[model samples]
Target: MPKRIMEGKVVSNACDKTVTVLVERRVTDPLYKKVVRRSAKYAAHDPQNICQLGDQVEIQECPRVSKRKSWVVISGGTGKPSEKRIRAGQDAAVEAVDTGKIQPKKAKKADEETVAEKTDDKK
Candidate 1:
């Protein structure tokens, strides 16, 4: 059988070589077909001790590292920057910055319009 890999943010890094990763799974009720989000926290082994709380890490199945740990951290476990994970983060930042089509930054203020300056200089 192949090992399973998961990517999520580290919610806890209080223990040595260990971190709690919160993995979210989406499921739908068979009867109602209602979409639901299921989340689980797994204790993963991070041997390098680089992961910090809130950091994003990729973990893979491995020989049991502890009573509760069934996975180990993978190298290049992308730290602070979650390159593409969407979770009330940078993507939201991009959206926050996008005020639809942007009004020119130098657009004259409403009270600053000048009629003589309105004619195109290029014309």
Candidate 2:
């Protein structure tokens, strides 16, 4: 029998040598007869750790490598975000900070000052 192969997007790569791929498929609802999207996450073995988040990868069924990982990454890098796109996102975030559109966390010194004021008020 032929092994099952699937294509999905890598949603997480936090585990060492493992990636979580999210596979989405459209199925027709029996009662409503409308098409609906269904998705499932599969833990795939990534020996090389080449797969990155948001990358489109092909996974193939294989003997279990771990408790939850039964699939292995066969191919990837087709849909990985480009360096320019990532840099653009970082630039946008910096611009937001510079323009005061996004407020960053307060410094520890400010927290200390607030704590001192509270103590003085109590006294």
Candidate 3:
């Protein structure tokens, strides 16, 4: 039998020589017949420790390297963050601002007075 190959995004690379890949697939619901996305996480071996978070990677089935790792990374080690990761970071920043965890820089006093005067003039 041929080894199974799958492409996914690396969600984590915190382990020494392993990265967690999140593989998503579309499946039709048996009862609703609606297509839904399903995802699974696989621990893949990365001997060189090159894979980074949000990196797209191809992993192939191989003999178990550890208790939960049976896939080996075959290709793809782009260090750039993916769009999803960037959006997540933006969301986190927004949340921090909303919760007062991060204070946004204040506008200059002159700028604030001008904006206030404009609003007053419109009234």
Candidate 4:
């Protein structure tokens, strides 16, 4: 049988040689027909300890590493920027918004403007 592989983001690397990966999947509700996102965290073995928090990684099923760990990290993932830098940028944006230093872009009311133009043409 083929082993399962999953792509997820590293949520924690606090444990030595082990990192927690968060895998998210979108599922549609049968009754409401709405899509909802659900996530699961799995502890994966990181031999080189290369994965950092928020870094996207690919994990594959492997022999059990410990009581709750049965996955191993695969190298050459998405290679996104470091999580710390990403969070710093995000925090700065949030701070700017909170301090009123910047304004969020408002969505354009294009449909409303088009209707108003049509009304003017008819009148």
lDDT at position 97, candidate 4 = 93
Which ranges in model 1 have alpha carbons more than 4 Å from their true place? Answer: 75-79, 86-123
Model 2: per-residue Cα lDDT over 1-105, one tens digit each:
899999888999999999999999999999999999999999999998888889878899999999999999998754565455568999999999999999867
Q: Which stretches of candidate 4 lie over 4 Å from their true place?
A: 76-123
Considering only N, C-alpha and C atoms within 3 Å, which residue pairs clash in candidate 1?
none
Residue pairs whose backbone atoms clash in candidate 4: none
Task: Give the Cα RMSD of candidate 2.
Answer: 7.7
lDDT of 1 by residue, 1-110 (tens): 99999877788889988889898889999999999989999999988888877887788999987799999988434456465665567667667679664344675565
The TM-score measured for candidate 4 stands at 0.63
Supply candidate 2's per-residue lDDT for 71: 98
lDDT of each: 0.79, 0.89, 0.92, 0.87
1-123 per-residue lDDT for model 4 (tens digits): 999998888989899989999999999999999999999999999998888777888899999989999999985333475466679999999999999999877867997899899999999
Residue 120 in candidate 3, Cα distance off native in Å: 4.4
Taking all chains together, each candidate's TM-score versus the true structure is 0.67, 0.63, 0.67, 0.63
Q: Give the Cα-based TM-score of candidate 3 against the true structure.
A: 0.67
Candidate 1 yields a Cα-based lDDT of 0.79
Give the CA lDDT, 0 to 100, for residue 31 in model 3. Answer: 100
Candidate 4 accuracy as lDDT: 0.87
* Top-lDDT structure, candidate number: 3
Measured with C-alpha atoms, the lDDT of residue 5 in candidate 1 is 93
